[model samples]
Target: MVPSIRFALRGATLLAAVSGMVAATMPASAKAPFRDLNHNGKRDGYENPDLAVDRRLDDLIRRMTLEEKVALMLHGTLQAEGGRGIGAGKAYDKASAQELLSRGVNSFITRLGPDPRTFAQENNAIQKLAEATRLGIPATISTDPRNHFAVTAGASSETGGFSQWPETLGMAAIGDEALVERFGKLVAAEYRAVGIQMALSPQADLFTEPRWPRGVATFGADPATVSRLAGAYVRGFQGSADGLVKSGVATVVKHWVGYGAEPEGFDGHNYYGRIAKLDNESFAQHVAAFDGALAAKSAGVMPTYVIAEGVTIDGKPVPQVGAGFSKPMIEGLLRGTKKFGGIVISDWAITNTCPEQCMAPTAEKPQGYAIAMPWGVEDLAEEDRYAMGANAGIDQFGGVDNPAPLLAAVKAGKVPLARVNEAARRVLRLKFDLGLFDNPYVDEDEAARVVGSAATQAEADTAQRAAQVLLENKDGLVPLSAGKKVWLSGVSADAAKAAGLILVDSPELADVAIVRVATPHEMLHPHHFFGSRQHEGRLDFRAEDEATKAVMAAAAKVPTVVAVDLDRPAVLTLLKDKATALYGLFGASDAVLLDLVTGKAKSQGKLPFELPSSTKAVEEQHPGRPDDSANPLYKRGDGIVLP
Candidate 1:
């Protein structure tokens, strides 16, 4: 047994030894304090003498006051803004962090950046802040899906220290649970090395619709598939061999119940068709994945900005109130029905709904005074966030600028003091479970050794290899002869930068630039998920595509090979009709692509989703429905014949 487990066992044995005589004389039906021992504040284990740690937790909870319980729920991320980046900018610093912790802030979320050494440094800085605090509340460094390609700005930099894998969709295409688990384990190790105690990732939201810009972040459409993969991911991330980081870094299974069925694939912008409205059966199907995640002991749950229609709060419908601040869903559904004992985190900047945009600065509205807005109107004030979110049982506030409002609310009797204590206690318990109190500092040298280590790079390579889907390979279009003057066509295909397959430090060394074809990120216009949809957001194909086709038509004069970066595979059908020889590539690194074409590596990937022949085919399918066989241009699981 691991030392931690053994230590726990010994501690339990000693306690039992002290109570043995009293226990033997007790009646059979009488309950013993041994039933609850660890005092971790969570009901984790059963009534067994062998399981003393469980008892200790029960004992701890029993001793905790209602105020302390409230403290356990008040988790706060140190950063103020919500974007795809690491570290809070000028808004928050070490001094502010110290001040917050001293004022009773229990949880702190930090970003994991591209560089491992930077992460260690940032963590060390936070450690000092924790040490300076009166409560000695250890901060939990939280990352936003850093395992894959770092999407956020500051997160992409090496200063935060994280390993980069393929996008989540790439992992889903691999369909290898064990590999996914391995990825999670590596990420956990990197996190542990950097003083990080929580991983708010393994985004389990199923990508029911492709139109959703964030769809690439999801595992895919199937709940069973997501469940198995997400469970493995959680197990790998939380479970540890030494029990040091075991319960590995606490996993936060996110966006809670239903975020996959969003209308028009918008992130949280549209709520019309987003919820899982089916009866208990359908709800079960969607929630089954979360069951697997919870079974893995996910330490946190984040509710989205969008609300379920039928779900209500104080006799009011959910959409009327921001879902993040809703009481019924968080308290009733998540905590009450699901029995989730972990922290409840609100989405970034979800507390500041008054100003329309999250990051925008605005004036506070009067109490109980509703205002008109494009999304909706409500008596929603910054102070209202605390009352509604806390009363609703939210334990943490993420991506917020000022927690002073929440603290002020507590002082003003807007929020119950008991609730604050509950939130804090829960945060403290998680820190204790993570062993952060014992050793909060991260070793920069050790971080360098582990973050982006050779093993992690190998995992990335493996993931990249598995994510490469061959959409179409017509008449031996691939496996080109090494000496042939292969003419690459299309803007994205021509420029290594646009291809996104190559991890280039410099763009000049690129092999060639065909004409331009828009990448999926460019084609779909990511901002549309926020509500804006204009042709400008569409692919700059008029100029770029025409140039690409002209070059490809010219390249057809020679023994040329045309490869298109298949972000949205539909582009390939257009390219296929024009090129003499064509091959579809999905997010492969340039090196990987070169190897495949040069016959150095074998292409093993199959399509995870169907490539429609046209946009019309896509429009015909139900927005969030997965079964699209009725009008699928090309069936899913289709792969090209490679020579």
Candidate 2:
């Protein structure tokens, strides 16, 4: 680390050099102010694009009031009118423009994505509204992963017109740093084209426990591999291997610490599934997985919703609070140990009210309305939670709109105003660095032209084709001739026909059969919102299961090819033994799979996480460890080329 004095000296020298260049190039009469952000008809330091980020941040924070700072720290959600863009001449909220203009809420996570042009328009409207405020602090709009096939409500979304690539694990399967970087660049471009400035993505959490519902969103089970891929992901999104740049999308590398180590493989999104078992030694490995992302200078980091059950730092038991609220987790670990100086944003709904519906739901009254993820701080008062979190290094609250609790806490000396000012500075610095204040509006035509263009789609198509891992190909069963009669399940008949395979009514009358199956899951808890949608529970295919039955019956009569969507690695023992050919899929489409089957494409990816031999193996393995099962069907890095 550079000494404060030396850093200051360097800054002064750079400023002198830059000022000399400007003076030498421009005449006094020709010079014009960069921006009139406050509409005062004069230039402010924050409004000047040429100023250093720190100088601009200092200027901006100095001008902000306590209420404005509190409101700025709250990362709210925006709703698009008609589910496309904000209503014309109106705030995204139903509130009047005067109400919005009075506050300093300048950052938001948008769920209003219908198309590229509409998304750009909505963001432009928000920026235009911000310009009318006392200080024209442009809003930094963020979104979850959208350039993918997976469309989990809170996790990832489908690309409306953006290039669709594999899930993060699929990128891990390919395991090419360059390829993942390319994919990230495309995602970054698509996001910026639509005026989205920040990306709440590139989850660096290791795929430790296979049954963890969010395993698919992660890079597979090795710290070194996860680190490499995570770094590439950040480099691509931020448009630099070194740090965040003006043209890049700010990447929030997420679920910090031990999120993937779900005890009993239950997700942390629910009350009953908040604990993640990580012994002192194993905890280090989990933290090490984020090294790559951190090294690449990820613009932000979001702490996990789960609590680390058995973690300690420097012989002290780490507080068993959600990472976002734990001083030990954030201030002590992330800041003191990892030295991440970027913005620390809390995961969604950390300060929300966990009503009866959210806490406990039955078959009839499922968890719906009041979604809360306060985890270890469930019983704390709202103001206490905010005070604890803001002091613990959380800069912003996700999924929260009202800033009254935080403001009250700050006013009553529960949370320090200094911490609030620091948080506000970080937020404003990011916006300034992204050049949002200069020009937040994107051309609608440019957005429409750039997003999901044929070139990007072609690139995505190739990635989809390469993400499939070949495991078993018996007796030249794969690369099946296009003229063969084929029976299909979980695969579209139209896709099979397009591959020139003659569709057969049943396996008995076909020369071959193509089947695609999701790694089987049980809806043990139908009450919770995430629990109902999550692919949870046993990773083995039982005989009575419909997908298993379909594969069995089809293989009974003809040579069957099976493709398992390994959202989480499945125990493929039975199918690998019975089917003539088998492949592992991350986010491949039916068309991509069919093309591979007909010799138009080839498998280029390897197994990302280990494929367990049985459900017993999955149960016996440690939640915090990776690829350590006693016996596995195929280990990580295992693959076969279908000839």
Off by over 4 Å in 2: 1-34, 82-102
Tens digits of per-residue lDDT, candidate 2, 1-643, equal: 1121110111234444654566557667636745456554456788877788888888888887788888888887676443322222222553432244345566887765567787677677777766666676777889888887777777876566788888888889889999999988888988898889899988889888989889888999999999999999999999998989999999999988899998778988888789999898788889999999999999999999999988888899878788989998888888898898999999988988787889889877888656898988888999999998999899999877677889889989998888988888888888888988888888888899999999999999999998888888889887987589988999988787778889889999999988999998899888898888888888899888999999999988989999999999899887887788898999988999998888899989998888989888888999999898878989999988654
Each prediction's Cα lDDT score? 0.55, 0.83
Report how far residue 41 has shifted in candidate 2, in Å: 1.9
Off by over 4 Å in 1: 1-92, 112-114, 153-161, 240-247, 269-285, 309-320, 356-378, 407-418, 489-555, 558-572, 579-586, 627-630, 640-643
